[model samples]
Target: MDYRRLEKIKRILQRRQPDLTLITDNVNNFRNLSAIIRSCEAVGTMEVHLVNNQQEKLYLINKVTAGAERWLTQTRHSSIVTGINHLKKRGFTIYATHLGDPEGICCAVRTLDYRKMDYTKPTAFVVGSEKKGISEEALENADYHISIPMMGMTQSLNVSVATAIILFEAQRQREEKGYYQQLRTSQEIYEKTIFEWAYP
Candidate 1:
């Protein structure tokens, strides 16, 4: 194995945020799902929580991910509620991406700008289905609702693009906070990831 390649993977592992992760609720497209996984890898996301109540089947397209799927850790759940509750117990603050009035998502309560929210802590973002958006139960379970500001006639972004945008914002916030500068993951896991990346 090349020492340079090993060093590169080691650097990435050091920056991996064990506290930061993503959740998908009923996203049906394999391409979109794989793209989300690619974005998660780019941002050094530790894990992905998938809620596929529609069916137990979940697929990740290799064409879309271009081999990125093998690098990401994913867990399957029967329902969004179960995933959200588990993350909550693990000290993660869940945020759901939904479109509504910025002043208030559902009512006049006030929705947050994705950039303004603190990502320095344990944060998990739930991106919903392309057609139906997030489920009501998922929205209700979220600690906050976040949205990207839009000005054009079309009010929505593709699920994969939206996931990338929010995750990059999180990457930015975590970078500014020096969250990525220190080692945050367990040594055993880090070693495992490096071996997988380096050997494979």
Candidate 2:
């Protein structure tokens, strides 16, 4: 690789947050999944976890992902419970997206403002399927239920849009904490990732 391109890859790898990630629960739509992956990449997220119980395989739309999937490491799980358990074992704090107290009815899990949460720590945002929202199991497993406040008549945002919003908020917080100014990934992984990203 040329010096400029190699340097560019190193710069990006330097800012990558290995601890910040996303976990999707049965988000079957390939377009939505692709967009989520793209957003994760934009925010310097190095990996993403997926729960795809309904389908045998998960596919991505190249047009939506815009080649961002190639730069990310994706882990697929058979169920949301399995995915949550895996992340929890790794010391990741789970933040499941949920709109609690809809129509004045109290939800079992209370919701917090997404902006208020600390994203600089090892964090994972759990976004649910487009149709059903987050499953009960995911909500129960999450360390906290978070939501983006809606102002108008609309009740919810698109899965991809919501994912982007939350991920960017994390980017904002991480930026303020100077997390992007230095290399957070280990030296071995940093060298490996930059080489792969440059060569691939």
TM-score, one value per model: 0.92, 0.95
TM-score for predicted model 1 compared with the true structure:
0.92
Q: Where's the lowest-lDDT run of ten residues in candidate 2?
A: 101-110
- What does candidate 2's lDDT look like per residue over 5-114, in tens digits? 89989899999999999999999899999999999999999999998888898889999999999989999998899999999999999999987642335465467888
lDDT (C-alpha) at residue 129 in model 2: 88
How accurate locally is residue 36 in candidate 1, as Cα lDDT from 0 to 100?
Answer: 95
| Highest TM-score scorer | 2
C-alpha RMSD by candidate, in order: 1.9, 1.8
Q: Please, what are the lDDT tens digits per residue for candidate 1 over residues 42-144? A: 8988789998877667777888888777777899988999999999999999999987667564455466877778888899999999999999998999999
Which 10-residue window of candidate 1 scores lowest in summed lDDT? Answer: 101-110
Q: Which segments of candidate 1 are over 4 A away from where they belong?
A: 105-110
